[model samples]
Target: MKKCCVLIPYYNAGDTLLSAINSIDYDYLHPDVIIVDDGSQITKAADVLKEYIGPLNIILLEMDSNKGIEHALNYGLSLHGRDYELVARLDCGDLCKNNRFSKQVKFLDENPDCYLVGSWVDFTDMDGRKLYTVEHPSDFESIKKLMFINTTFTHPTVIFRSNILDSVGFYPTDTPAAEDYAYFFKIIKKHKASNIKESLVNCTIDPHGISTIKRKRQIKSRILVIAHNFSINKYAVYGIIRSALLLYTPRGFTVFLKTFFNPNR
Candidate 1:
């Protein structure tokens, strides 16, 4: 496999960051890892990095202030992504499947037209119990259609070509919590993107995370993303209605629906 590294944005991640870094099967891919500390006040998160002794290089960058994850991610991209062929993403509390990087790297190597690629993810609880799985459409057409209503790629399960960022630019910081959605929207229009059929990551759905705590803002930003990408078409309406329900209804209800009626399952 070509040289690739993982880029992780850290902010008060505590031990989760260390655990996440350790979980990657470095012996298989031997990709260097970079974690940009986004002005985390919690010292433990930063302190734990000192304990990671591994075969792969671990680059830790620091920011003086909390500038949000979008900026932190862009900071990492600007700093180190230029040298690697691929850059994978793994959030603080996420666990990668043993073959995650190998599969993603192989796919990127084989498909040069694909700018970015992601895989299915399993959403788990604090105790690591699987709650539900999110599987995205693998074909570009299905992904584009679904992008209006939902995020087609799992963020933590992605391994994108380095040039894709060069072409599309870094993640937009304007959207706050919805930067990934907006970034993907731009990517889908400019280049080919798809997901692997298998689940490659287990994401911890923290109730207090931005998705739950800032659902209203995220939904609003998603609606704006739809407006920017598609005109007033059927897909736009579907996007609005889907976002409206998530915004208006209680999160618990939406979680229930996702757990029980998730189309991928």
Candidate 2:
């Protein structure tokens, strides 16, 4: 099978960065793991690179200052993206399940029409306690419809074709905290997208992570995404209502409601 690259944005990731890097099945993926350091002054990503020994090609790109994840991601992709046919994403703390990269690459390779593929993820607490699993739609039609409500692909669980950049471009800075939501929405509208039917990664739920810290901004951004991609349909109307409603609710409530009704999870 052909090789793929992985994009990881790190800022004060500490040991979780190591866990994320170590989880990749290097031999199978033969990954060019590009890590962008978003000015991590404390508990740096470089600290892990210094002590590690591995077969995977781990490239580190350091920005002059902190510009947030969107900038770091685009920086990495702008320079390293074209060299590979596929790009996979993993956050600093997420652990790739066995055969995750291989399976994703193989799926994209065999199914030429599918531009993006993600997997269900296992969410865990800081102590590695199981929180919940998020299962996304596996069919293109369902994904396109459900995306109106929320992003179907968990960012960390996705591996997408590089050429889609030609159609959809890089992650949009305008989306603020919900760039992936907007980007994935663009792809599904233009091409087929789906998820593998099983959990392919373990994503630790960081209480102070960007999703939590910028919860409100993300929800507002989701509003913009939904409005911009608006179409007249039952799911679309309900999606707008759900996202707008989420803006008023606390993050805990939204998380609880989603977990309680995970839709065939």
RMSD values for the candidates in order, in angstroms, are 1.8, 1.8
lDDT of 1 at 86: 86
Error of 1 at 93 (Å): 0.6
Question: Model 1 scores what on Cα lDDT?
Answer: 0.86
- lDDT string, candidate 2, 100-134, tens digits: 98888889888999889999988877898666788
Number of backbone-clashing residue pairs for each candidate, in the order shown: 0, 0
TM-score of 2: 0.95
Instruction: Give per-residue lDDT, candidate 2, residue 257.
Output: 70
